[model samples]
Target: MGLGLATGMEFYTFDSVNLVLTDLTGTLGVSADEASWILTVYSCALFLGVPISIWMAGHFGYKRFLLGTVVAFAATSIGCSLAPDLDIMLFWRALQGLAAAGLVMWWRASVYLLMPKPQRSPSLMRISTMLYLSSAAGLLASGYITDHANWRLIFLPNLLYAAGALWLIARHFPNQPKPSAERLVSADWPGIVLLAIALIALQVILNRGEIDDWFGSAHLRILGFVGAGALILFIAWQMSAANRTPLLWLELMRDRNVLSSALLGVLTGMILSGSVFVLPEFLRNVASKTYSATQTGQIMCVYALTAAAIRPLMVGFIARVGQRKAIAFALVMLIMSMLIFNRLLTTGTPGWYFALPLVLYAFCLSPLLPAVGSGTVARIDQNKLLDGVSLYMTFRQFGASLGVALLTILISHRETLHSARLFDHVRHDNDVTRTWLSTVSGTLTTHGGYTPLEAQQASVRMLAEQGAHQAAAYAYADAFAFMAVVGIVALCLLPIVPPTPVQKK
Candidate 1:
């Protein structure tokens, strides 16, 4: 219960800000682009904070660290609510993200440390269900709150969630021996610093790359060089003999099960997060059925609920059929779902056309984390379980960031190409174009009380608008096609994942 509340709260906090961006822009008197930094900074801080949280949990014990982070999360929530300006809000949001990282990491670590082997898979699925529901609820709740009340009120719910988590954890969590001061002093500060530098640069690039025109921007180019250098140096330092206790256990990647699980984490994360980012934008701006924020949130709730409902069944199937076969099936489902999305997401398609693909995608997502997580935990050394989980999670985060960046670039590039091709046929020289424009202009002049010249101009403007929408529709379809390709790649790699151990009958 404690883990569920804490995890849900963290997920909710991460997502709730999505609906409130417009409100913040207006109330805080910041531009839309500037207001986006509120989210970007939080994401960067959250990723950077993950490694730091692992180290802290090791030193301070998970229970104490969890409680401290909960309190910090609550405090930061209050700070965010009361923030007077954009700068203040961004500062508080960054701290909130750091607190959230600790909360998420420690809660999962607690499960791994405390749960019996038989119970871990089900427990993880339940928590994952809560995560999906909470994030979905965040979208709906924030939209409602933004509609009915001040945007600041969105952070208030965290206090209630934090209080419940703190009470439950404090009363029931197992106690652990305190670490000695020597352990703290021997911490890998150099590795920590390098990791921080690398993550910050990488996250900033992921979050801002589309806006900044990616490699074309001199700023991103320098960041790319710096991030790559730091990552390389960090790897070299970790593998060196002088470093007794590394921040991350690089050697753990040698285990085939661990490596495969981590790789699966990357692939699934890309599909899940990338689709979430893309689908809403498509519905709002590209699809024929332009949905309001509330309507889009409702549609997303269906996806989340379907995944939550099917998660346990999928986990049970994985246990019966084994991870390799189960994952192969899921990948096939993913490919089919992506293709379905590509086919259905057209400029004239109705919103209901997405339900089938969403359900299929949900089925594809439901089994992945639990199967991979359980397989990883079953295979890794008990003493190094936390390290294994942290590594897997970090890979997942990186994959999600990469997915969003790549998909964004793909959509933009494809839209430009599609728009160019479409507009090329709209010239006055083309018979089809001339006839269509003349018919529309004639109708406007006859019934709409427009002058001949005005009707012609309006007809051309309408055609341009329609063409733009069609281009966007084509671009989104191409995005899903790209995802289908990714799914195929995942399917091809399934052979690399070792079979789960046979149970004694």
Candidate 2:
């Protein structure tokens, strides 16, 4: 449990600090688009690494693999802190993602392996709570550090957390024998390579598409073709390798409960991770009011606390209502929360305006994950349980990757459209526009200690800035509205998901 908490902290330390991107960009002498690769590469690596790690864990024994990854994560953190260029930082971040790939998987899998069946649910709930709390705390801690210290310093504290995790694992974890040689040699190497190629191409296209002008650029076109082709081939390979050591558990997709859970995991991943990626960026860069990392972290905590507060009720609620209905309730709350977010968006809205919807979102999302996960594998064949868990988690991480890509593209595209529309009315010949400009100039001249020409220039710049800000704010609102619609569509799938008893395990 202690090791799990430390790992969670290590994962989230970059979450909030990434919000203050201007700080990072300025320090690294990179454009904002390039600086974003710091996150993109990590996610890409993580998404591609999960299934590989799962198999590796079985092959090498869980204890050694877990401990080795922890050490790698610690070493990469030091490299990230010391990196002097964008390429170097991205390299280290990708390595960190590979090292951190199966931390959550190991923690969850350990519960089932180490405890009797009756103890697993409560233990999972407790660990889930700790993980969520650590995620929230990470944003807050990063914000505090970014405000008081340099951006490089944000990576420093992970060393301590990593050390603690190492100590716990080394002293307490038990050893297991490695898998047989035949089992190791039968691994699906080609399928793994195809999946990695597909995901890497997709990530690059998503992150670079807008800047490269999407289909207009040959770079994006080739990547799109490669990603599409590789994905199709990967699916074919997985289906053929069912008798071998397949990377994906292709058989599990035939189960209704597992299939539904995987689909919902995609949506949940999109919504939760998308919110984290977009909200802070919007608040700091697009919104009119300036929010420091600390203030943004406080807003995120509302989500974590609200989620934590509702967790104690989840197990009982699912037991009484069934997993399908519980998920239904969660979908409703989640949809309503997104609607509230769309309704409350404004360039200069009060802080509380954002808090209400986030809290509501927390209530629904907190329980939704555990319910879906437990239900997915509850009645599965004992031998296939590991495959089910790995598939469910891999899809969830893939969903997160999609969410970030979608939101990034949507925000950028909408901002351009909104800015163009808003800028159309800013003509000198328009009486209302001229009057506002004159008024602003006069005010600047009188109170800002500026000459007439200087005041006029300042007024023009101010109006342009305001227009850009308002456009960006509208773009964020559009993204939220899209999420609300997605939730509604997900709600429609509820009838297909049969009710499973919560305590069946």
lDDT of residue 344 for candidate 1: 86
lDDT of 2 by residue, 1-505 (tens): 6557556655565564555566778889998667777776876787777888877887768888888888887788889888898889889989988877777567776776677777777887787777667767777887888888876777777777777788888888877666554433356788888999899888888888888888899988998999899999988878884447778877799998788888887887787677667677877776677888888878877887777777777877777788888888888888888888888888888776888888878878777887788877777886577778778878887887788778878887998999999889788998988999999999999999999999999999999998888898999999988888778877888876777754554
TM-score result, candidate 2 = 0.94
Q: Total clashes, candidate 1?
A: 0
lDDT of 1 by residue, 407-461 (tens): 7668878998999999998899999999999999999999999999999999999
Residue 108 in model 1: shift from native, Å?
2.0
**Pairs with backbone N, CA or C atoms under 3 Å apart (clashes), candidate 2:** none
